[model samples]
Target: MRVGDIDISYDDQGDGLPVVLVHGHPFDRSMWAPQVARLAPRHRVITADLRGFGETTVVPGKTPLGVFADDLFGLLDRLGVERAVWCGLSMGGQIVMEAHRARPERVRGLILADTFPEAETPAGRAARHAAAERVLREGMGPYADEVLDKMISPTNVRALPDVAAHVLRMMRGTSPEGAAAAWRGRAERPDYLDSLSRATVPALVVVGEEDKFTPVDVARRMHATIPGSTLAVIPGAAHLPNLERPAEFTDAVERFLATVA
Candidate 1:
């Protein structure tokens, strides 16, 4: 669906209370396929391609994460989702924070998976930006492979070839300009620790045991900041535990939801 000037593409399925699934940077709605399959049986699952990632192509000049949040709200409005339990991963987590900041009443609960509330430090941001630029300059093939290798556990990469292939395909499908824009947007997100502290809704902070991208320590700190949020770490997984260890990831989510519900 076209929301404002952006072409917002989403998959809506199953029944019950709404659960919005948001994906990380350089990937699209397809990245949440496993979660959708697991959650849709008991929840109204909505997975969207954030602006500029999947079918949702954005205008070249846009650079704000708030705009992406607006796109999410617009999608909810178009779909008649008044209040939803939000599950966001990485960039998706950033968007969820923006949504809570923008319209707290629309959110029932929060699930932040492998994401942080603030940008990396100046030096770290520079290093990440440089790496991203190198990826763009060199083309996505090598970078996509490297990204998959970093995102999932080695066991999943070698044993679950299909999962690894799908992730690489999703990463490779991203446009270089879009990927750069996403990285830039993420690097500029506001310090949202205060926002997390202020949120009263039930929340969950989840991470993969081997999530070097957003380590378990970061997830623990986030859990500490959020008054009542629960923290869960999926064993033998990396950045995307939901993909590498679907059963464990889904179980944690389900348990969290039971508490929140």
Candidate 2:
């Protein structure tokens, strides 16, 4: 689909209410294959590749979360979808939150996985810019090597070899320029926690029990803030719980969605 000047590659299947799945930074829509396959049987599942990632061509510039949200809203508009349940992980979750903040009427519910709403702290802002510079100087190899192990829990390294390799491939294949752009853009993202009370829609917060990035505490905090959000932690999984524990993640989402509409 053509979203503004860029072409967004997406998979839209099934026949119920729209449920859009957005992948994290440096990753593509394929990360949601597990959830897509399962959700396709029950609802209108849409998985999209964000700019600079997946098949989407990179447009050089600072791509803010608001811009990403606009692209998402545009994608849905082109598809004739009025509203959808926004499901996102990590960076994608931030996009969903921003999109909801910008256009609350367009979001039916939220499925935030391994994500948080706090803006980057002073040290984090510096690190993100430095990381972007490092990636540009050394390419994605160093960054990929550093994050691969941290992306998944130690237990998953042995138990889920395929999962580990999957993330590695995604990271390695990601466009360095795009990844750097996202990292820089994230450094400028605003904190969404303060106004979260205004988001009255049903939400499901899923995080890996062993997630080093967002962890269980952040998930609990998010659940407590969102009006009536449910929380589910996938045991032994790390950052990408949906990929590591698809069945459990899908089960959690299904139960939550069943209650909403």
Candidate 3:
């Protein structure tokens, strides 16, 4: 669906109540392919390429994260979906939080995967900006392999080279400007811990056991703050557990949705 100067591409499949799955940075709707395939059979699944990622075009100077959330709301409006259960990964998690803040009435539940409430710390923000700068200056190819190496578990890196290559290719496909804008906008996002604590929506937080980027500690903190939120750590996976352990990740999501429903 094309919405407000942007072509928002999305996949809507299956039946039952709507469940939206949003992907992280440098990835698009394809990142949720495995999840969609698994969950679409049991639930209505909606996945989209957040603007400037995948087949979506980049709007230079735009705050990608904010626009990304707006795009989701716009898509939901177009689909006649009044409310939905949102499951987002990494940058997608940030977008979901913003969306929930914007339209709490439309969010039935929240699932924040492999992300945090705030990245306001000097060191953390600087590291994010530096990574963005590196991507812009060096281009994505040179660092693509290294990034995938770190994001995926060592076993997956060794055994699933093709999968790793696909993720690297997606990273290379992202525009430098878009990536940088998203990084900067997300880095400056306000702390949502307080909001999470007071939220009425049922929330779940999931992360990989070996996730270095967001880490288990961050997930724990988020879980501790969000009242009654459940946190699950996927073993033998890193940042992109959805890709590395699709079945396990899907099962966890199913369990969470069932409990919340």
Candidate 4:
């Protein structure tokens, strides 16, 4: 669908209460295949490729979380989804929080998976800038290779052969400009703890037990702050728990959705 200055790629499946699944940095909507397949049985599942990732147009310039949230809203409005369950992973999770902050009434519930609400630290900001410069100058393959194990546990990378390969494919396919744009966008994100604390709806915060980036401690803090959000840690998985432990991840999500009504 064409939204704003870019064309957003999305997959809308099944039929019931709408549930929007947003993917994280550098990856596309395909990351939610497991969740989409499982949730579609009981609810409408919409997976979208945000700007600069997947089949979406890789427009240059900063894509702020607010802009991402607005784009999501535009997609939902076009689809006639007045209010729906929002499930976001990594950067997508931050977008979900931003969308809720902008228009809480449009969200029925939230599923923040493998994500955190904190702003980038001084060093983190510098590192992101450096990464962006490198990716833009050279390519994304090197960074993807270096971060594969960090994205998912080394044990899972060896145990589930396809997951790592899939991540590599996604990372390699990403537009360097898009990747840089997103990295810069995320670097500027503000802390959402205060806003998340005021949430009135149900939320499920899922994290990987072995996640190095956003560890279990981050998940616990988000759980404690996000009103009545449930926290579930997928044992032996890392940042991308959904891909690393699909069955367990699906169960955790299903458990949360069951309590929504």
Clashes per candidate (backbone, < 3 Å):
0, 0, 0, 0
lDDT by residue (57-174, candidate 4, tens digit) is 8978677899889988999888999999899999999999999999999999999998989887999888988889999988989989999999989998899999989988999999
Candidate 2 per-residue lDDT, tens place, 163-207, comes to 888888888888878888888889898988866777889999999
Tell me how candidate 3 scores on lDDT.
0.84
Clashing pairs in 2: none
User: Candidate 1's error at 194, in angstroms?
Assistant: 0.4
What TM-score does candidate 1 reach? 0.94
lDDT value, residue 24 of candidate 1: 89
The per-residue C-alpha lDDT of model 4 at residue 177 equals 93
Cα lDDT for residue 23, model 1? 92
| TM-scores of all candidate predictions against the true structure | 0.94, 0.97, 0.94, 0.98
Model 4 global lDDT (CA atoms, 0 to 1): 0.91
TM-score, cand. 3 = 0.94
Query: What lDDT does candidate 1 reach at residue 94?
Result: 83
Top-lDDT candidate index: 4
Least accurate stretch of 10 residues (summed lDDT) in model 4? Answer: 59-68
How do the residues 151-190 of candidate 3 rate in per-residue lDDT, one tens digit apiece?
7877888888877877887888888877777777766777
* 2 or 3, greater by TM-score: 2
lDDT of 4 at 59: 76
Q: Flag the better candidate by lDDT, 1 or 3.
A: 1
